[model samples]
Target: MNNKRRIDQTEIAEVSKIDTYKSIIESLLFVTGEPLSIREIGTIIRCNERETLEIVKEMEKDYKNRSRGIKLISSNKMLQLVTKPNNSEYVQRLLKTNVRQSLSQAALETLSIIAYKQPITRVAIDEIRGVKSDRAIYTLLEKSIIKECGRLEVPGRPILYSTTEEFIKYFGLDSMESIPSLEDILNNFGEMSKNLKSE
Candidate 1:
């Protein structure tokens, strides 16, 4: 008699390659609820951006046909697999929780000033607001709503901060051109600068 080896064909008996891959996909999803850049996702997954992006796209297809509650969404240069908003009420009702944060009225005002006048310096923001915006700028940077666009070609060569891609998406704007008219700006503006100068 000859002895033969048997494979454990049970579905859940052993972890499969597909399962490992899905685990990676699931983990990538947990890193952020917002759409993440391919480079960022790759760094987390320990893979090249192209490979990670392909896997994500495939995972998105699988998610669509399955009963899984999460859906992978790609927008611009980012990818996000999030719980469908339609399920938000049920999820919230069951969890009895909400997770959200927003800028203060002052921070909002300061950011608006920068949005209209970037690539602009902090001093200019202070000039328009008539107050120091160090803290507000710090907050905006921390939130990734604004970033250092470049350094101004002036005496101090102050670092210029401009709105980030997140800023546009958060405001539901396609681009800066849609930021509203000067009249709209005037109406919404809280302060103005007397020595208005641009570099």
Candidate 2:
């Protein structure tokens, strides 16, 4: 009986520790207002990355099941808390502006190209699009949807651009692998063109 009692106590302590960790994670995410890498979170919570990822995954499931207004989003092993997309309208209304404005056709095209062919140079993007993408690239950079990833190791050494974490969150993707296949995106391009023309 005493052994059973000790076992129960141990289990209770473990559960309490997990709960504490969850609470700490919630506070960290809320305060940071930015994505935190799993390793960073693990360091703070005093757990290994694998264990931290498991806890975060559990929290994500719980938040979804609870139908919470805020949800956890992750990409590139980084996690952040964000309002549900369905609640964007209310958020925008409160902000008195389109906080999540739709991208222009040019910007969308440029973003798509960068997302799929990341670390690509501007000249390469221009070659693919058959037009200079300076304006579109500028807009994407301003919006933080894309960023300078590096400079190509060529004679000219032009800067390379890649999609950012904000891009993943904007597209409601968990990771780069979550992006639709190139063929799928190509299939949808026709519809996108039609919608853009209509606008």
Candidate 3:
């Protein structure tokens, strides 16, 4: 009976450790406000990939059971904590106040190009905009609306840029697909600004 009791205690301690890991991962996701790859989580938590994925899955289940405004989303094996779709209106209201800095027209133009032609290099952006866009790219990077996604497999291996999750939040978009097509924007850039402002 004493041996059985020790076994039960050991099981309980193991469960507790799993719970602690879940909480730690939850806090990290909440703080970062961006997608975290399994490798990134493993590095932060000092765990292997399998262990990190297990804890993340467990935490996802727990969040599903409990009523919470935020939930986990996975894209391309990257995990991100985001407000539930049902709570988007409320989240947008709060975000608007916090994100009051107006975007310049140059920045808007650059951002529009990126949103449509993501994974594009700086040279492509310049070609589209018909001028240098270094400052606009820098501003967007500073605002976290865009991020360096990867490097193009060409000579010089220029950095490829793409929209961040923050971009969706900023535009109150359901997803990247929600953005109007390039044709729509080309037909009427002013219309896009008006619609975004109304949102």
Candidate 4:
């Protein structure tokens, strides 16, 4: 009976520890309003990354199942708390400002290309679109949707571009893996174009 009592007490302690960690995580996310890497979170909580990830995943599932006003989102191993997308209208009304403006078709195409083939160069982007993408790239950069990641090693060493965290948030994606397959996108585009041509 004493051994069983000790076991129950141990279990209770473990549960209390997890609850404390969850509360700390909530506070950190709420205060920062920025994505926190799992490693960073673990460091703050004095836990290993693997354990932190499991706890965070549990929190994510709970938030999703509860349909809370705020939800947690992750991308590139970084986690952030954000207002639920469905509540955007109310948020915008409260702020008296539009959340975001629509992008141009050219900008959309450029963004798609960059999102799928990131760390890509301007020349490669132009080649794929069969047109100069300077304006579209500029627009994306200005909007903080994409940024120069690095420079290619080849001659002329053109700059490489990659989608930003803002890009992921704007698209309501949890991660880059959330992006639909390129083949699927191309197939859908092909069908649309075929229908347009037929009409």
List, residue by residue over 106-177, the lDDT tens digit for candidate 2: 889999889888889999999999997876776577568999988999898999999999999988899989
- For all predicted structures, in order, the TM-scores are 0.44, 0.53, 0.53, 0.54
Looking at candidate 1, the ten consecutive residues that score lowest on lDDT are 1-10
Per-model C-alpha lDDT, please?
0.73, 0.85, 0.83, 0.87
lDDT of 3 at 58: 88
By lDDT: ranked, best first: 4, 2, 3, 1
RMSD (Cα, Å) for all candidates, in order, is: 11.7, 14.0, 11.0, 15.2
Q: Write the per-residue lDDT of candidate 1 for residues 151-175, one digit (tens) a residue.
A: 9898978899999988998778989
Task: Choose 1 or 4, whichever is better by lDDT.
Answer: 4
Cα lDDT over the full model 2? 0.85
Sort the predicted structures by TM-score, highest score first: 4, 2, 3, 1
Q: Who is ahead in lDDT, 1 or 2?
A: 2
Error of 4 at 110 (Å): 17
Candidate 1 has which clashing residue pairs, if any?
Answer: none
* Candidate 4 per-residue lDDT over residues 108-175, each given as its tens digit: 99999999899899999999999988767866775699999999999999999999999999889999
Please report, as a residue range, the 10-residue window in candidate 2 with the lowest summed lDDT.
134-143
Better of 1 and 2 by TM-score: 2
> How many backbone clashes does every candidate have?
0, 0, 0, 0
Model 4 misplaced regions, further than 4 Å = 100-144, 147-199
